[model samples]
Target: MSATRRQMLARTGAAGAGIAFTGAISELFAGTAAAHGRAGYGPLVPDPKGLLDLPKGFRYQVLSREGENLRSGEGKVPSNHDGMAAFGGKRGGVHLVRNHENRVTAKIGVPTVKGLTYDPAAKGGCTALALDRRNNVIGERVAIAGTAVNCAGGPTPWNTWLTCEETEDKAGTNGYTKDHGFIFEVDPVDPHRTGAEPLTAMGRFQHEAVAVDPRRGVVYETEDAFQKPFGLFYRFLPKKPQGGRGSLRAGGRLQAMRVPGIPDLSSIQEIGASFDGVEWVDVPDPLAVRTPIRHQDFGPKGVTHAQKLEGCYWGGSSVYFVSSFARKAEGSAGDHYGQIWRYDPSRRRLTLVIVFGPSTDIQLPGESPDNICLAPAGGLMVCEDGGGVQHVYGVTRRGDVYAMARNRQNIGTPDNPEWGEFAGAAFSPDHDTMYVNCYAPGTTFAVTGPWHR
Candidate 1:
């Protein structure tokens, strides 16, 4: 590890909310004209492989590619690779559990096996991969099957992965025989033991992502609906997560967040404006049959609104979440790329750590910050799901944002490349490899470099 990185971790503790208050581009990425790259580790050198472009000393290799046969050889690797989590393998290397955000009529889905599915009619689920310490894929298989829109999820300190359904589709709705929109757990310690069960107590809404507090077993959830109606920031205090892996199913209390004095907190349009003394409102019924739990159950009860709460991560002792693209288009009051908020459970305080305003520049320091992973070296690595050319932004505990890697791949055409949204950004437990997914064509890359530098 570099001395510079060690100092950053020691000075700014991740346990509490720390942020770099500057909007300046990362000095590390200021590229010189001759090298066609920026400072930091050096400007990103264009990849001759035409997959990913990285800085001078760094390189990336495709870990998993779409259209490939599964390790079990039942179905092809599902497309629409969304959120993911990385864990230290039981034997060696890294174990990553990934989510496939498939819909009912999707062409590719998780392999359906007997005695291991929730709703066979549902097409979305999660898959697990085992990679060697060299970042080579050793094995891959389905972890959880038969769910819907398995979007973003977080890894538990207990060595399991929590995969969430982003849909509120009920059993009878859209040909689904079973109700959807619930959180599912996948144990990497034993993949076959991962059954098709939803943590129903978490609530049924347009679920986005979840962050589990390692100490208290409190699960922080985000809702991803349109902005006008907005979504709620939720917390599920598992009654007995002490039972381990599937304990959340034992039942828990579900609640929505509220700013003490604000009815619609989504409209608060200020960067770095802190809201202390955050309160929680209990939700009477989390499983809504006729309407979404957010629209009908909590809207009228003064629960605060968040335009589109997407990716969230639990680290140190707080939950960090991204409100992606809050604009009038999504029904939110104002327009901006995104906002990052931190909620400290112990203090009951919520801080607006970082906000990205309007920007057309593809190389801007901060864009749409989504899908966050707190690296072991200390600092948040964010996935960008916004428009234009995209890159993963590295954030300090104090909220200083910098360009870590840029996407130079061509999707639409060579003349007009649309950098697809970056998702599933997680660093390996050893900190030697960082795995992230490109939404289009569904590609997962193993990134390694002097991350400590």
Candidate 2:
């Protein structure tokens, strides 16, 4: 490794020691390296030649493409697809709910919803597709009414998908008079006829994803803001008892996490420390209900920020979060390395699971680990959000890394390209099939594996 990278590893090791121990650091490095080396032997699938690489015996077919005519005959194809969730309907068909993370791009087509155009220049939105057992599209519907930059979100236990808008604006001209960031719930089967009002009770922030604890009605949320000193991490507790569902706007208690033991390193030393655990602080009223301007009160010490926290999931009795743009040393340009953190609600503890960056021994060249999905066999599938040679990677709980699929056919310019990999990674209810979405080409894929690993 390079000298700079070695130094980075040393610093990361020290941080890891502070969080857990040096032994954990060694295991993290060794496990990831070992996993990458053994990737080719784990599972074999017959992947498409020259399109992307996969294990032997795995095959994929196109499910939906941008601008393709659906049951509604809406238009050609949608663009900037991101997070997705799959639900099995009573009719034995699977319903895939997807997010379109479109920015201010005019080339991508927008949904035809009246008074629901959040941004005139916004191209991406959210859609739900009903697929038969054979993975064919039975129907399609646009769920959320008006929103922009719809990023990665999680599925609720109540059988509803939470779609998050990842934009925070000072000037609210983008069809969002209330706030730029919020979460919306949509029924996968009936997307077009969604409720008129949004679930505003789920605090307003630059939301990236939401993970709900099935036992507790507590919802964990991640933020993707960095323009300020610290980005915020939040948890919402519904006021009503468990098993109650209607709209997120009904009522809930919003609270921000505060790492008290670890000082605010950015302000004091111009560098943040790599601490492992976090403490929670309740924020009674995020948006002052009494005021018409909708001002947010972040409490006294304010919110503690981390690297750009993008994707999150609830697993192993803890919530896992990924920092896409983690700093290498104290003061360095954001590196490609990302770190996965596990937050245990039972113990109220935060643990640093693994760190990914060029500085570390194991490196992933991707810019951001946008969205993540767990495998029934015990591992994670991450969506790459960098440029050139994008792919979908599988990582084990033991820190093993493998490149499961690549987007060779989806390589082109940012806009108006043949294929560009995005997010929306979901597994079928039976865990027998995998589904993925491409943003540049605006398409979805259904793949079947031979299961003889």
Q: Candidate 2: what lDDT? A: 0.63
Q: On residues 1-453, what C-alpha lDDT tens digit does candidate 1 reach at each position?
A: 221221111112322222333221122122211111222455567788778877778888887877898887767888778898888875568888889998987768788876568898888898888888888888888888888999898877788888889888877887889989888888874666768777888888889898878778788999988635788899998889664877888899999898877655556645456787898888878888666766665545477887778988765567788887676765666665677777887788777655664444555445567787765444567787766878776665344345677776667877776767789998887677789998767788999987765
Candidate 1 error regions (>4 Å):
1-39, 297-301, 363-365, 376-378, 397-400
- Candidate 1 to truth, TM: 0.88
| lDDT of prediction 1 | 0.74
Candidate 1's displacement at residue 367, Å, is: 2.1
Candidate 2 vs. true structure, TM-score: 0.80
> What's the CA error at residue 78 for candidate 2, in Å?
1.4
Q: Rate the local accuracy (lDDT) of all candidates.
A: 0.74, 0.63
After superposing all C-alphas onto the true structure, candidate 2 shows an RMSD in angstroms of 5.9
